[model samples]
Target chain A: MNCRVCKKKAVTAIPRHNTAFCADCFDRYLMDQVRKTIKEFRMFEPDDRILLAVSGGKDSLALWDILTRLELDVLGYHLDLGISEYSRESTEKTRIFAEKRGYRLIVEEIESEAGATLPVIAESTKRPPCSACGLSKRHLFNRAARQYDRQVLATGHNLDDEASRLLGNILHWQDGYLEKQLPALPAEGGLIRKVKPLNRLTEKEMATYAYLNGIDYVIRECPMSADAKQIFYKKILNDIEKESPGTKQFFYFGFLDRSQKMFPYSPEASPPSEKCRMCHQPCYTDICSFCRLRMKLSPFPDPEQFNGTHPDVISLHTED
Target chain B: MPESKEQNPDETESVQENEPRRRAPTPIKVFNAQTGDHLEVPFQKRVSSLLLELGIDSETVLVIQKDSLLLPGDSIDPRFEVEIRPVISGGSGR
Candidate 1:
């Protein structure tokens, strides 16, 4: 097939958009999409320094490439969960990519910072692996942004990630999570502003872009997420999307347009009234979840004896 | 190699003389990037049909042939090697 714009040879097809593009056109199209998404959501100012949470995956790497191409002031941040060889390889890929592109990168190892890896934390606390990891990553990402003086934190979450997450939240009637499913979340409380530039792009598109742009990334999934519910939701959504080309986009973008406003999430309704005694971070209780987790890992007294709250609800953040 | 007990020289010669000689089409070698499995399948028709035969959803993966993305309606040449890369990712970033 010929390119939709240049009338040359096409390299990829976006079925949902009903158009195909050559390599040069697709790259331009992706950059334009990122710029449009940023402008539409008012994600950040051009002068604002951004800290990107990259996992050495196609989405984040592609986003980094686009942002750099756009000449935005962006630095890459990677959190090593210390998942044995996986963490090592992931870190290597991120570092290599950054070095090759002359992009500054910061690597934080969870084991060194928290006195334990993600697997250890998950096992000791009996929390779900993903939950523990997510909470830790969120805290660290925010902390890193603050430490580095960056105003915005960008992640590699694509259309499939958000759509599947929305499906899971809707399936379980997790109303609280619905409000948090936007392309941009303003910096509130101690949380750094989070933005997903690739939210409008699909995983296939991201992968294709990475391939065409020669961006090397880790192709394997996290070993801990073998049977994650997120994967199942994605599969179900893909089945629906195959039958209806634009259903995934409609379901997610439609929520942002109309349904999201119906279920408003007001952070002020129950803000972090108190600060954690340990880390001085904003939290509802004396100690934050990250501090509580560290306390559990340490030889100190049990945190439960003081806060009277269970370990599962250690964090002030509520996850679906 | 042992010869088949049911083999008949006269019958084989007669069948060979009557049937037209036609070479079988080469099968496309597909590599599943997610599972790291190698498989071969006939081109059949388009990318969509090929994915259907492999029991993979077209939405979840991009079919790559000679480093180019193939559309569902794009016909793949059997001589080319194809790679099926799954785009679905989950859990926390490692």
Candidate 2:
């Protein structure tokens, strides 16, 4: 059968869609989008070491495959969130995949590094575990990259993720967040430059790429992420995509194509403050948020007691 | 961290007037604040707490004040009204 999109000789039959793409064309289409996004945004320099945040999921696995195929100097960084059996399997799969491809992989277990598991953290904080997990992942990724002297950290975030986040930012009119959501964030004094090469590809495209490439990855969702807010936005975007086949692409690429003319870059904008006392990463406060939260989760004073009316609120400080 | 009383007398006087003497500091109201449960802490509290609250390093949230952005190490006058805006994801997608 001929492929519907590329009109090439079909490889395997796509179960539900009843259409198929030739292996070469399918890989090319996905990789081309990534390469275009990289070039369009100048995501990386020729000599920079890129730490690819791989989650042992299709999106990230596909991203690593493409980066390697493109001959980009890249390594894989996976955060082990310690989600019961699921996290262990994902970690092992990610490790094996990286090792087979001769790629360097850095796996950091949160339980070991922070001495707290996700469930424990969630129970103590009353906040969803995903938010804390994301924060820790980001914090550790940047710190690891800096330690390795890698100048760029690449993530598997694709077009769907980008569009969902865009919608969230738009709903709240979060200018600060919107400003930093560009494809390529330049390297500041303390931060390693971050890029999302898969920003142009859709979730479907990534899944297809992963399957076609025969990359081993975990298909299960994080048990803790079942009720995440981002999941709501993703579902909304997915519904929109079902109604409009290329809506996600149109939204994200449209922004990328017109961002320079439509938005004036803020000159006074500085990289986030890196003065976190605990982590010594860039932060606006003396102690980093991760450390503070960890401390809060530990045997510390109650946060509710600190709440008071404005004017008196300043006097409320956590007694160390 | 220096106590308010330890600062220079001239600086201390200026802060003393603005300092919250009887109650917790009121959140500097922004027009149409972001939705969700709005817990408005003082700019410093928001910054300090959010760093831990969000489990993010301090550099993730950018704080702009007094025509200059404060670094993590930079000393900020608690008296100055600080704006708490999250540095979020960006692009042109609607």
Candidate 3:
């Protein structure tokens, strides 16, 4: 097949777009797609530094490469979940990429700081592994943004992830989650502004981009995510996508375009936030979830003893 | 020499070997990166057919030959080494 843009020998085919592109053209097309997504969502300004939450996977690394190519001020924030060899390999990959490109990176190890690995914490707390992982990431990413004085926190969530999440939410009729499902979530009540610049791209496209551009990423999925419901949803969506090309995009973007307006997001619409007495972070309850988890693990006699004294929060950006 | 009604042993073996070579193709080695499964797939005209034979949806995984992404319609050589990497991933992203 011929390249859609330059008519060169095409190497990759984008079935959803009904087009093919050679290596060089694919790179340009990917960058253009990310650029359009960023601009379309008003994700951030030229000067606003982007703190990318990189998982060392293809999606995150690919986004980091694209954003750097677009010449945006971007910093990488990596959280080591300490899931045995998986965490070790992924952290090493992220470190190597950052050092090779002369990009600044912050690495935080959950086990080292929190005294337990993610799985251990999840097991001890009887919470789902992904839930624990996600909560910790959300708290830390927001904290990292504020600590580094960055305005925006960007995640490498692509079309598949968003679409799958939307499907799950819709299946459960989670109106609150549906309301918060936007590419760009405004910072509210001490939360950092969050954005997903890769929301328009698919995982396969990101993998291909990484492959062609020589961006090395961890190829393995999270070891603890074998039973994650999100994966099940993604599989169902992929099956549907196989039957109907562009169904995932249409369902997700269509929501973003039309249905999203039905559930407008307002800062005041959410539950009121109060400063956690333990960590001083904003949470709906008296103590934030992270602090609550830490309290559960450590069994502090008085919450006041640890007021404004979370070591992980202060030392998150340090090298291991 | 009663021109033996039987073929020479060497000639008979040569014909027997050439018959299978003409009928059967060298299977393509497909490595699944996700599962670390190596499979020998029979030759198919297009990449899509090979994936279908493997029961993999074209949208779910990538079929790569020598670092080049093969479209579903692209013809694949049975002698070429191909890798099937599943693109679906579950992570902490919500």
Regarding lDDT, does 1 or 2 come out ahead? 1
Tens digits of lDDT, candidate 1, A1-320: 78899998888888899899999999889888888999999998768999999899899988999888888899999999989988898899999999998999999998866678988988988988898898888777887898999999999999999998999999998877786778898887777788998889998889989988898888878888998999888888888877888999999999999755677666654456776765556677777787777767764434453353433544534563
* Index of the highest-DockQ prediction: 3
Q: What is every candidate's alpha-carbon RMSD to the true fold? A: 8.1, 26.9, 6.7
Question: Which model scores highest in lDDT?
Answer: 3
Candidate 2 local lDDT, A186-255, one digit each (tens)? 8885878888888876665565566557777776566676666665776676666556656766787787
Q: Where does model 1 exceed 4 Å of error?
A: A265-270, A300-320, B1-21, B42-46, B92-94
* Chain B structural similarity as TM-score, candidate 1: 0.70
> Which 10-residue window in model 3 chain A sums to the lowest lDDT?
A300-309
**Is model 2 an incorrect, acceptable, medium or high docking prediction?**
incorrect
Ranking 1 against 2 by TM-score, winner: 1
Q: Which segments of model 2 are wrong by more than 4 Å?
A: A4-20, A258-263, A267-269, A299-320, B1-94
- Against the native chain B, what TM-score does each candidate's chain B reach? 0.70, 0.38, 0.70
Query: Which candidate order results from sorting by DockQ in descending order?
Result: 3, 1, 2
- Quick one: ranking by lDDT, best first? 3, 1, 2
Task: Tell me how far the alpha carbon of residue B4 in candidate 3 is from the true structure, in angstroms, after superposition.
Answer: 29
